[model samples]
Target chain A: MTTTPAADTAVTAAALALGDDALVLSHRLGEWAGHAPVLEEEVALANIALDLLGQARVLLSMAGDEDELAFLREERAFRNLQLVEQPNGDFAHTIARQLYFSVYQHLLHDRLASGDGPFAPLAGKAVKEAAYHRDHAEQWTLRLGDGTDESHARMQAAVDALWRYTGEMFQPVEGIDGVDWPGLESTWRDIVEDVLGRATLTLPEGPRTGAWRAGAGRQGLHTEPFGRMLAEMQHLHRSHPGATW
Target chain B: MVTTTPLEEQLLELAGSVPDPELPVLTLRELGVVRAVRAHGTDSVEVDLTPTYTGCPAVEVMSLDIERVLREHGVREVTVRRVLAPAWSTDDITDEGRRKLREFGIAPPRTGAASGPVRVALGPTRTREGGPADEPEPVRCPHCGSPETELLSRFSSTACKALRRCLACREPFDHFKEL
Candidate 1:
């Protein structure tokens, strides 16, 4: 059966949203390349960043040509969720963000792998990587949370500050349709709760609904920060389209 | 009368012949990454490999390479399975493989030296007392065999390597991390 224009667009948009999340978070993680708390962790974070970058390349490249979808599109035309676009506040914040995002990505990719979609193969490949990322993040979360008093305090502050953004990750965007998968958000919540419990951290209870401060990251509408990130990422490509080393 | 190659001999030869794509000098056999090789029937062979590093990107390419090489050698069907548990390590690099790495300009990793206590220094707001430093240990220069060397970069061309420069030779080379 031929896919209708509307259906194809919806799939394309949903893919872009997912792609943007990977891309922005990859960028944020790249910021920690030389600056991690330890040398081993520096390598670990960079490796994780490279994995996310690879995923972004495949996902975004599939959304359109690698050039147009990543570079030519304007801020509003991009579709990353806001949680990924948020700044990496500190080491603790970065770890907290990773904990939440990796858990969500692992669950989402696990479910998506079984779906009868063209993206299933890609998701299958990504599930393995995401599983490792989740493990890495969870390890850090436990370490920071259960470490000394200073580390514990910093980690708790990070959790409090970033918890609000967690809600948006599970919130489905309108206009990006065709995702009829079931139980993904609940699965995500269960995984997060299990991890948090293991980490010996209490889940912060807050209003799940609030004023949506960050908007349109998934619909190609992104914050000013995304533009800067894209500018840096796309500079080489935009300078010489079709240039190969 | 034509001679038939025994399945064990053929399997051993097939597996022993395949080289790791990333580090060409080491064979899967020498690295101990190749866990098992089995013949399914007269025409099919299965190769099992464990990754040397947790996130080695070359594992996929290496699997495909194994299949291609086996097919070229007349194995009709080949399957490469990646086993995760009992992870491969530098300790698994055979002595011959260690010599090969040294001859190829990359240092063979020191066994049982993968990780140690690392001191990290936080800024003035920091409670930690010391700065980032690994415990003192002799890392022999891969090129000159001198024990004097300094770290140049934690990251190298590949994830498994770190860049270190030898004081004696004054050449930068990739030192395969113990991990």
Candidate 2:
């Protein structure tokens, strides 16, 4: 579709929001390359990370130069949700984060794929990848939430801790058309509730968003951990501009 | 669909003949990634390719191989573009390609189902029952031709394959997952 300049700016904003989400989370997941609890788990996380990275490249390229957008941009300039930049505290915490984000991404992509828009082609492809990611997180959630007393407690704690960041996900992104934000949110909640119920855990009773923090990250206001994460992610590229093997 | 000239058709065949960088046993044609080829003129050609997976690292190598093969065949300028619509599915693999994959000791993906993520049950047997009719067919052992196989890991040596083990023969093998 041909977009006017104003529309193009909105599209760029939307792309940056979604693209930054994928990019930041992929880096966080990649951090488990050496320290994952098991060999298979490590491979699985890396594979998921790679999928997200690929998606980030496509989405970022839609906005501007992919490398410059990923490496040169300052932290405040990023439009990713704060949920993605939260630290991966433990295995359960990571799974919780994955569960929260993958479900939203999958649902969003599913909707986007059905529409004839700028993102249709990408959403058509990425929706499937997001399905696998959602399944992976769901599988882990089931296992950990029901496995043992300590495991169950940890899983519950992780989900609870991450609950506050989730409300930002349902906020309407500009330039994205034909989305049912409330419908999407309700569906997400229902699916999450079903999964948690099946896993023998209860949905957290905590607030979905902290006061004054709704959609903060989309405004380029991120948490403290995000700054440190960006430093590490941007270091090599910043040190040697345009250097390649 | 656009009808191709004989020259474009010939270039398509050459491009499709390039072996997949990750799976040497299968050509790009067999893998269904080489989507379309159009010649801009006598020497310059534009080829449309699709990735098997978004993050498949081998796509770069596959593109390079296609360019090299086409260039060697007297095409002076070759451009490869990645397309994403009508996303690639495991079902896109031709029947001959599936046979070749099985012969190569990897279980080919089960066909005739709409492509999406396979649901995991996490039960002792890890089997799905009473699901919709479109539920995927069982993945048989490439080694023993047994339907009793179990998934070991969703992600394997590559994104397209899943690590599975045959119950009958107890041999670990990779199954090209239904994308």
Quote each prediction's TM-score: 0.61, 0.96
Model 1: how far residue A114 lies from native, Å: 1.7
Write down the lDDT that model 2 would get: 0.89
Q: Can you write out model 2's per-residue Cα lDDT over A1-245, one digit (the tens) per residue?
A: 56689999998999999999999999999999999999889999999999999999999999999999999999999999999999999999999999999999999999999999889998988888888899889988999999999999999999999999999999999889999999999999999998999889899987888875689999999999999999999999999998898
User: Per-residue CA lDDT of candidate 1, range B1-179, in tens?
Assistant: 53335775777667767788888888888777877777877688878777765446787777888888888878899888876444455677889998999999997777755333111110111112133454434566777787667766545677667677877778878777664
lDDT of 2 at B115: 53
Question: i-RMS values of the candidates, in order?
Answer: 9.1, 2.5
- Residue by residue across A1-245, what tens digits does model 1's lDDT show? 89898877767777787787887798888888778887767876787787677677767766788667776776777777766876777888898898888888877766666666756756655665676577667767887888888888888888777777776666564433334434666777777777667767777678542465444455455555767777787788788887776
